[model samples]
Target chain A: MRNTWPGAGGSCLAESITRRSRLLAAVVGLGVLVVGGGCGRAPESTPEGGGKRLTIGVNFETLQTEYWVAGFEAIRSELKKRGIDVVDSIADGDSSRQLQQIRTFITRKVDGIIFVPKDARTCIPAIKAANEAGIPVVLFNRPAAETEGVRSVAIVADNRKLTRETVSFMVEQARQSGRKHKAMVVVGDLGDANAIGRRDGFYDAVKGNEEVVEVVSEVPSEWNQEKARSGVVNGLQAHPDISFIFTSSDFLFPAIVAALKSANKYHKVGTPGHVILGGFDGDATAYQMLEEGYLDATGVQDVYFEAEQSVQAVLDLLAGKEVPALILDPGFVIHQGNLHDLKDRMWGARVMGR
Target chain B: MAIGMRVDGWLPGWLKRGVLSDHLILWLSVAYVLGMAPWATGFVSVSNAQTILAYLLPVLVVSVGLTLVLIIGGIDLSVTSIIALASVLGAKVMSGEDGWMAGNALAVPVGVLVMLAVGLGLGAVNGFTVAVCRIPAFIATLTTMMFVSGFAIWVTLSRKIGGLPAGFVMLGQNLWVATVMAVAVTWLAHGFLSRTLYGRWFYAVGQNARAALVSGVPVGRVTFWTYVASGGFAGLSAILFTAGLETGNPEMARDNLLDVVGAVVIGGTSLYGGRGRVLGTVFGVLFLALVDNSLNLVGLTFYTITMVKGGVILGAALLDTARTRILARTG
Candidate 1:
């Protein structure tokens, strides 16, 4: 049956948030004026530059992804440790509202803003405002789709590096097993730049490796387990591959696992055959699969490290120091042997208080 | 005898065609046969049925909501985008991934209520503009469609938020729960329209807005509430989606709106509204789920699926047109 779609408070939430934002800005401005009056200094663009106050803004596409929560908390904590004031504005995943929040941040006169833009194109206006306001930005997780001149340093896991290496492990497994042959690839939302990168990375590395003709069929699962699981079901029926299978992310590992389990791929020749399915991210299932000697391997992207690097990038930028274009490599591959000890490593459990 | 009856000015051409071509019966048989064939090639077994249903639940729920709105002659283009909004918001409010029990319990009430309110509010906007300002429902909802979809991606000031507590897993992960939700929405909506006064008004409004107005019906108010009801259902469907994902991303439901509307229309429901039953919408939804699930088993590319879906819609429209003509001639 056809169902309807719902939303949040209409004009009420909009009107209220607007008033609250304006009021908060006014209050922060007055407080700044009083502090500046006593110090007898114009707003030192970089407040923390010379024994001063600094406000850092944390802009999230929306605080809805678990990985980002730990990542953002780390950014907030690290910046706080450096004596920086953290002002976070969650857009709830609305691109326009996010643009509005960025504008609001600029109006609030924050020293620096950390943005996780939902839409790369919609980010221009907001990024421009922050740039014009002399606020440096650090992007976390995914970068703006096409950031030609957006003044931001993205502290993401070397996505290409991670996926390429993980696929290499699967290839090596197949080589070691003497079952070097064909493979199939199940993918996520093609619209996402991240998914595109992961898919291309895996295909590029695997396609030319051998005569292993991989049939890559995509279902727009969009990183969801159900959809991914369904994609696996589709793939199994479509291609009777002679080799490895790769799902783009660790989040999809469980779904791939389910698809394999249902297909009884677990029944093939002595032990679970050399049919390896790969994933990306450090989610529980990805780690568990390694612990149980499940599929092949996964590429781990530490949320905490990404967050810490984002903070460092902002600090270095503000200090007028040359910041390296660093790609933090989160550790990868969890096999049956080390699964127990890595329980706490799944999320930033020990790192962030959350 | 039929020609003689018509000659007495007792029937119009369309009416004569309707009695013969209402072909609501064909959608199910056709959808089922089409759905089963690919799966029959040793791909889709009964064990896979549960798995497919799990994947289909969220979409099914949204389709049901769209069905209700379609009957009232209103459309909710924002259903997909609103799903994104609810999923994200629900995730943000949850305690963590396993927080399904308490987290979803509390969140469900709040999320559902907010969705309901938003649904009504948005529907009111469409209804008001369409009814009061004389805007087409399609145009009004389309504007809202753009806004909600933009909101799904734009929110969070640019960060992905996730922490659904363990409790939410059961809320949507449980097949029974999802099924219950689907049935509940369809039944409530069905009851409201088929057995209630408000429902009749929807039919009356759809049958002829000017006639409905002249006949002492609160045409504008009915139209407005029709949208509100449609939106409320959208919110409910979104909440279910958050439960299913165990994490909400604002961009997740961006592809669902058209599918939901398509299901409604495919179920033998007229775009003119006031004529289709919830049963028809339900069957339409099931037929779609069958097609979608079966397509996955056959491993068709998304592009192929798109073509199939588009073809299905066009075919349904043709069936509708053909039936009306046949009924006019025969009945």
Candidate 2:
């Protein structure tokens, strides 16, 4: 409605030109570096299974989230040992920017690229751009847009299977505890595919286990801790009778612990030791907490390994080797007894992450 | 209708006043409670109220300044973006383990000064655009918001920088901090509204810019400064909120604009401008916070809360119109 709402910021000709030039130069320089760095030479990379020292541009949907960070770390360590460089452009689950990062990788002409897209569908244009540029791509953690030529290798903890495993394990533990304790399942982001699977899986596991009445609460957190913190706190207060908070991600467990710890009722719930906080994606913090008697059990995920496997799949494509469209396998869940066994593996991964 | 207070002959005094009243705000609150009674009774509890208040403090702080901008018939969409920028920049400044900007140093007067200056400078940009360039407040603030958010996200790069020593999250998370802030902002905003000439000028500008200008008021200057003040308040909230979260995610507080607006509106401030009190906005904020807190305690979904909020806004609008009509006919 305002005709005189000042000209657009682009009208400042001199400043605009300067900013544009700088931006353009930066972009060009980045592209050249990516091409040079990724496609170095077959001569240098001769022995020990070597080729052009490829730079695999790996963009993640927020390395901040538990599962994705693990996946990225795995890719980084595996490739680092194999002499492959990875230029990471990580997004904190922003859909638009995730696509932009992917497009940028395409423009940079990297030897190969991998991405865990934010939205399953919106990232197609970016994926198509990489395809047009003849850059091999591998998607991990989450699925691809439409699944064309991009050798998508997701190292998913097989949500459906893990959900079943998580519930089954927790139920078994509860049954063994023999203490007629009821548990409430705190799900993060109920609408999510994995969340639904876990919810259904829990129901499947505990439907017949009459000991667990499954006192559900209102307002699913959508996987946000702040949201889940309140959800759990209220869940605890209203249904002090509830136990066994089976969540979707490790991110929510920390909040659940914080909430339950604040209430001091956390000790009263679950299998007499720690509350049964079961979920997928093996976060280091959650893993440690389990060993410390803060948790009963958790369904683990190999996020970093998954990302690495996906990257390897891309390399496989480039080397004229066969690539699978769906790389599906369930990562194992480690209890207190087995958590220590993962210590060496975790330490090794941490060292490699650097 | 018979008990209507009249001033202009049979004309009611309420009619002379614009759409933003305590009664109207109260009705909105009632509507929110009633419309989502199923969800409210379903989940929210006392502890849930604590969580909501914890999140609501930063939003209320920002809204305090936002009310000022709205009072002068302007809005600042840039508050959201400013928060993101401050968060990222704060992370960089406070990155050191025990350095001047890191950990224990966050409570020092120096850190406070830096925080204020950052907020003030960001606000000044919006002020300059609306004041010197004579751009509409909406357009100027919107562009600034987009630019600031973009830069903030770019600077942080998907990382949520944490480890703020101790007490970093106190200002945003502590009940005492929230109460102190709410009281202080209320007193300050009330003084600005009722005790200041510039504040009076803002009212005049909102009511009728041409009349205010003709009567020797500097409308542009008032509009500009309001934006600056709004931005500064936003920065302060950003710093406090970043502390509360204990991790500065450039992505944090991105969706809080809705709450800020809701607080001001539910407090009985007209989005159309010219008629709303800061104190009223504070009450509105508190009311919304109460609702948000109550939602969790009662076990309601985020989606259900949104639905309740919509109903509350509608109820507020209806009451505002009703009161306006009643006053006009009686007076």
Candidate 3:
């Protein structure tokens, strides 16, 4: 005779039932925790103006880089000072999950939404959903597609122009050297609009200067360090004479350094065998590299400026004020020439407490 | 006559040996290298060889461990996440800036041990879920992967931890050291699979779990240990990656899952389990590294390289199916 009691079972059937019950309990418990946590936040006290605190939902693609982390912190802290509450979500580079997050924010009745899209096109529906719920949406650092019947304020840097300016400085240096230099360009993921803009900007700067700087290789990094390292190593092997290197993002500097070191080419700017390096998105690493005389120039996106503008745009929309659909931050290229004067303005320098 | 028989007759006697039959991908990879040499500048040079080997070390190490899990009819989708988590955790212990053991002589060793411990602990959790709790390996490992990845990012707030001690970073910069580590791991794993009773139990269990249990093979123990071994190997791979990249990043190896799985499968590891070889996996890794290196040397776009890689993997899978059918007929 088989025992049917829950604790009496050494039998398979008893074990199966016990396991099922435990699993069910766990699932139910998790659901309750999620729901309770969502509803359990302490409400902020009303301001002196006798209005309820404004709660905003901010969705990020991924905080895998310093730029996104700085931007998120800036916006969150700045909004807190204004008595605004923030609910944050990071999609970790998943567009479908980002859409779901937006839906959750809508269900929570968030007053406004700010998001950095994983891609230009797939995130439009998320904006549309916010619009349908009568919530203002602000696109941060990345713009949505120009879909008719959709409205949102986008705070973005001019990636192409800034990249062109940075590369132009690299070109000027090459011209001063009075030699034709073989070049390698490390391109980022083509799916990202910023990556595309940077790549095009690189081409724009090198268009007529082919006589001074000839691009010998285009290494596609997909914003991954390992891929960048491998691509640079292989590119150097194929073109050993490459002296000019430009990467789409500053985060790839370590990878470039490693690859160049392996090839016995890494040196100071004034030293022989030194590869002239230029990067975009001036991060702390780029700042250090520039100071060390290893990096020639970097396209510095004003993260603090962009973050402030993004929040201001959302607040303006809530105030029934008209704003332009696109508020652009015309970023500048920082090189050694003006590093001393403008170091404070570079977000990466500020983050490093330099 | 069938094309296979005709081709067999054209082959040399040594090449027709049964041992050589398992290494068809090896010969094909060699042929590929020679074929691409003329078109791809510097494809066959010594410096390029170093690049391929250095990059191949981490992936190969992880795949070697993954092969054991596959042999036991289990899947581990969390190895990449383990690499990332282990990297950051270990980096934190040995980092030059305020690390737990900063400026201490034992920092490097202790940090390495911590990485291994994390891998083993995570693996044990997976083993317990699948072996004891009866959760499917796929679902258990998938959940573990998601949790570990998220936890890693949260620990560092997605900031990269750099400034590792020189002694620790040397392991990655020295090609000879990395090569020795990778070779030793592969040799030990191969010996375990071929020369031990426990190893044989893995194949038996994978072939038919119920039958193995009836045969008193300790199916649960074998399944549990296989995942643990895979995790430990991922930890070792993490050390190499963290040292090689010279930074501890939460996003390290995020794009390497396909390479790991693809290399193992292309090496003729049966996804359904019960059969695989360490040597075959080595050649599979070499084949992929060569393809990636050569495509870049040829200046092909990333899109083109991706499509070409996908095609190659598909062809290898088809070859695996044909090889299995031939072996069955011979038996």
> Among these predicted structures, which one has the highest lDDT?
3
lDDT of 2 by residue, A39-95 (tens): 322112111344356777777766656566556667777888888766666544543
In candidate 3, chain A reaches a TM of 0.86
Residues B1-331 of candidate 2: C-alpha lDDT, one tens digit per residue: 3323322335354533433244445434444544643433221222223334444567777898999888778888889788778766765666544334665444334454566676788899998998789888789988998888878766665445554534444565455666577668767877988899877898898888889999999988887778878878887887766665455556656767777887787666767788888767765775665564444333333346557657756665555555665556745
**Candidates sorted by lDDT, best first:** 3, 2, 1
Model 3 ranges with Cα > 4 A deviation: A1-354, B1-20
lDDT of 2: 0.63
What lDDT tens digits, residue by residue, belong to model 3 across residues A1-354? 110112111123332444455424432332232222223332122223456778788878888888888888888887888888787767666443455456556645678988898766556657766787789999999987566777999998899999999999999999988889999999987656788889999999999999999999999887889989999999999999999999999999899999999999999887888788999998989999988888999999998889889889999999999999999889889998999989989988888883
RMSD of 2: 24.0
Displacement of residue A178 (Cα, Å) in model 1 is 1.7
TM-score of chain B of each: 0.80, 0.83, 0.94
Model 3 DockQ class: incorrect
Best by TM-score: 3
Task: List A-chain TM-scores for all predictions.
Answer: 0.74, 0.76, 0.86
CA lDDT, every model vs. true structure: 0.61, 0.63, 0.79
lDDT at A99, model 3: 56
As for candidate 2, its interface RMSD to one decimal place is: 25.3
Give the least accurate 10-residue stretch of model 2 chain A, judged by summed lDDT: A1-10
